[model samples]
Target chain A: MSEKYCIGADVGGTTIKLAVISTEGEIVKKWEIPTDTSERGKHITRDINITIDNTLEELNLHKSSILGIGAGAPGFVDSSTGYINEAINIGWKHFDFGVELKQLTGLNVWVDNDANLAALGENWLGAGRGVKNLIAVTLGTGVGGGIIANGEILNGANGTAGEIGHVTVKTTGGAPCNCGRSGCLETETSATAIVRKAKEAIVKEPHSALSSIKEITAKDVFVTAKQGDIAAQQILSDVTETLGLALANLTVAVNPNKIVLGGGVSQAGDQLLQPLKDAYSKHCLPRAAEACVFELAELGNDAGVIGGASLVKQYSNEQ
Target chain B: MSEKYCIGADVGGTTIKLAVISTEGEIVKKWEIPTDTSERGKHITRDINITIDNTLEELNLHKSSILGIGAGAPGFVDSSTGYINEAINIGWKHFDFGVELKQLTGLNVWVDNDANLAALGENWLGAGRGVKNLIAVTLGTGVGGGIIANGEILNGANGTAGEIGHVTVKTTGGAPCNCGRSGCLETETSATAIVRKAKEAIVKEPHSALSSIKEITAKDVFVTAKQGDIAAQQILSDVTETLGLALANLTVAVNPNKIVLGGGVSQAGDQLLQPLKDAYSKHCLPRAAEACVFELAELGNDAGVIGGASLVKQYSNEQ
Candidate 1:
């Protein structure tokens, strides 16, 4: 009762990371729950509601003690209306999840693309904490991006404002991307892309360390590349070159002061950052290259949940 | 007095257009004066001040009669400090032009990129009026872009927020751009690029209409393409495809509600627009494509001066 708190939920396919955060962005309490994606994720809102209720009861807090709720979901979301688009496996589209969550929890609700939330989270409390204009890139199974310009999300006409993954990196004779485009940054630089590129390279370098691994992963490529495996190093070099070019292209387009690289691939750290910085400098305009700084995302697993809370906190403050 | 007015100046290499704009977004009067590139364009500010004072006195108004002065100049700018960067042609980098003008004229001053002002002008009084978010592109000798989101300029760090022209369209083996990058959108879609592409294609088609003309131009390419000239049609198709892909990439990155195309090349009209739109739809994500619209920039040649005035007007209103 002495302090205000907002609830945040980061929804993924396997689990939902939830948090109760203070107004100042410190997480007061946090937990995770298995995602009940049954019935096309219809049970998601109800589940969140029950979790919130049970958590508050466990803490001896009342519903009125909470401010609002914000969520990050892995789908195209119309944040203005909280409409989540697509659930291919479940045959669902446009859940209008914000309204459902609001109805169940009796609180103001905001929902946006998961990566966008991560971007907001990073800008507010992570690697890009002080920078008002920044770009957050998630090098996950698929490449994802969130752009923040002048302290607000550049959510464009639709909610797909920061779809940096799909920006064409290779115009011709490029690999196809899941986004119906070929040569997208996602196709060349994502964790999946790294694994795929390494697998292809192993055909030519049968004696390389990567070829000996039955299940080659992005981590395997990075680990071997760092240990002086020429084939794996070549694959990573190719990946970073593509990403650096894409980042350079993005820097020109958005001109963010900071670009925070996160998600799985970023874990390779210096192995990825050094080459990426080199490629970016080679590709970027002189003025932009001099001004923009590149770094890795810091908030780790908490980015999404904290970003969810930050969204709600910011929204509440605005209201 | 019963009415308020503001001064706007749009500076170019050849000429400087000035305007007296009423608070209601109407231009009361406008005129142009030659630019003095002497002293690396340092005398340009004194020239603007002298002109403003002369114009104010001629109109029987005092300097205080106007609210402030807003200006548009070419190259990267720190709008906050009014610092214009780079002047290869004129040696005019980092001129605190606004402060000098503000001091000389004894009024508030604002300055931004010329293309950005053009976008603001178009958004305020031209095609994108009432649309809070849009991307304005000037397809001049080089393509230039200005992005407006939620009614504010997205002037990213160092003021290079929307460099849409330089976005990479061809990942490998494309034309080189002035920005020192290869396969940039500017390389494929700018007026200079169009002519370059045509001249290169003419080697294979000696009997084409383009070959008949000693100096092949963008307009010639469009006209001949309209007349079923194979070489010209191919050139136009290539230009549109590249431009459409660039625009599509921009849409995915920023999700602007409207994309306003202006400048010399856009004068090709529907011959360019129809194909450009088709390619845009082909390249854009379906959801984003559905929400976004394309329109020609209205206000024409006057966009610069008016955009300058709009910036001051908006600034004054904010105050």
Candidate 2:
């Protein structure tokens, strides 16, 4: 039997990342293509198909040597059918991207939410390697999460199983959220939320170092905190305290082997992790706290594509 | 080959309920035996073994006719090995109950936490039948929970995946929980918590209907609320509002098809269900709220044993 390869594509508003991964979990080649949002992303799947054909031809790989396609999209995706119910960023609504790609390339396809794919990728090759249970949280523009339980991603009853961002952290008098909820984990802990907290903290500490900057980022907060700015340290404390409690509560529910922290805010690294761990240890069940470990996500920008490839492998095995 | 049967035992602090169930999910005969907690429950498994042997002889059924035994015990049980790490109620610090039972009876044995067993039973034949994802909550003296995701019981890293009771709700300045955490869902919605709320409400409403009764119970609060007692209604509202929010948060994480309400407090039925649904609908993500439903558990006290039988059946299929 010839060596089998699988294609993984991560579709985003800016660009689509594609990777050719071997069955042994090595990325043979990887590249990116611009995403066409015109006409409701109709050309998106076609463009992906064209790129795969061109790439295979260039590499001298036959269709039989490729396993399948695994795609990750932003939206409420039906994992089994790769149907996008709604992806606001790319303007896809009720689109069958997976089936179209499969037909175009003559291979099986699996699709999942981008956040879920990132979790799968991290679990397979990053911080969660060798562990069957993991929870991956992405602290980017918005807080997103993926839960891997008993070695499978949990998509819940409505394909929203890992909606960790919406987990209500504040019971009352919380800031309003985009989801029309109040006091969500996203409201207090996302990178955007950290900037919002910094803006608010500056109002109280007008003479602080952060007040001098016209615009502040989460990274700036970490740098300023390291320089002994009280306002920045307070924001870090508040965010990690809230995030720590929420993650602890979540840990008790799913009991993952490790929690992989990724995205923009996690770049702060140990500055964010130490306080969060302290809060988690204080709040989490002693048994679960002792058993579970926390680590930074290692795959970075490649996690989604890698996870997509893994999806194809997992589905192929099931078949 | 003659039809084979399995034994299911629900071990409690006071009694052990045993049942003979056919592989087709029918309970043929059921009975109970007093649990011997003397000597740190050392003789409990032996007593159960002797009883099983006597029951088989009395019914003229041979050992070969039985497939295996499935048992449910209180506390932190390692499901795969059936090792009782620490069952505080049964006085079992560290015991291999499953191995002892299997050695004594010459049959395979499977053991799991009792709350988890109830969830399995309910999902297998009760409210969650035909649903692959389910959450079962027990509102007894204390709160207990079990999660079934993708048709398998989720025993996370250290066997505590469904500790829904400990999900932090109050967040700060709330009542302390037995788990050394303050403001847990269990601190607000357990049967004991309901009575505590009722007592506190009666003090404020001195002329209310609940003040006339001594030693108030959770059932009393339900009955009085139905009879238009303002104080009782207030207690119901407070408890359910907290429970509704907690369950709504939990639903977002696991996304179960059905949330089964079991244990003593659930006997309040519609009085509890209507308010909980209203609050859940208010707090849950609209898509998830529409996809999930709440139901009162059907198995009641029999849920544990029935779930144990299901465990044996499930383990048998895996083998």
Could you say which candidate leads in TM-score? Answer: 2
> Which stretches in model 1 have alpha-carbon errors above 4 Å?
A87-92, A171-176, B60-62, B170-177, B180-183
lDDT of 1 by residue, A263-286 (tens): 998998998999999988877776
* Model 1 residue B110 distance off true place after TM-score fit, in angstroms: 0.7
- Checking candidate 1 for backbone clashes, the offending pairs are A171-B171
| Deviation of model 1 at B223, angstroms | 1.9
| Inter-residue clash pairs, candidate 2 | none
Docking class of 2: medium
Q: Give the lowest summed-lDDT range of ten residues in model 1 chain B.
A: B86-95
Report lDDT (Cα) of residue A313, candidate 2: 83
Clashes of each: 1, 0
Per-residue lDDT of candidate 1, residues B15-41 (tens digit) = 989999988987888999999998789
lDDT digits (tens) for residues B119-218 of candidate 2: 9999877988868889999999989999998888988988888988888777677788988878888889999898888888877889889998899999
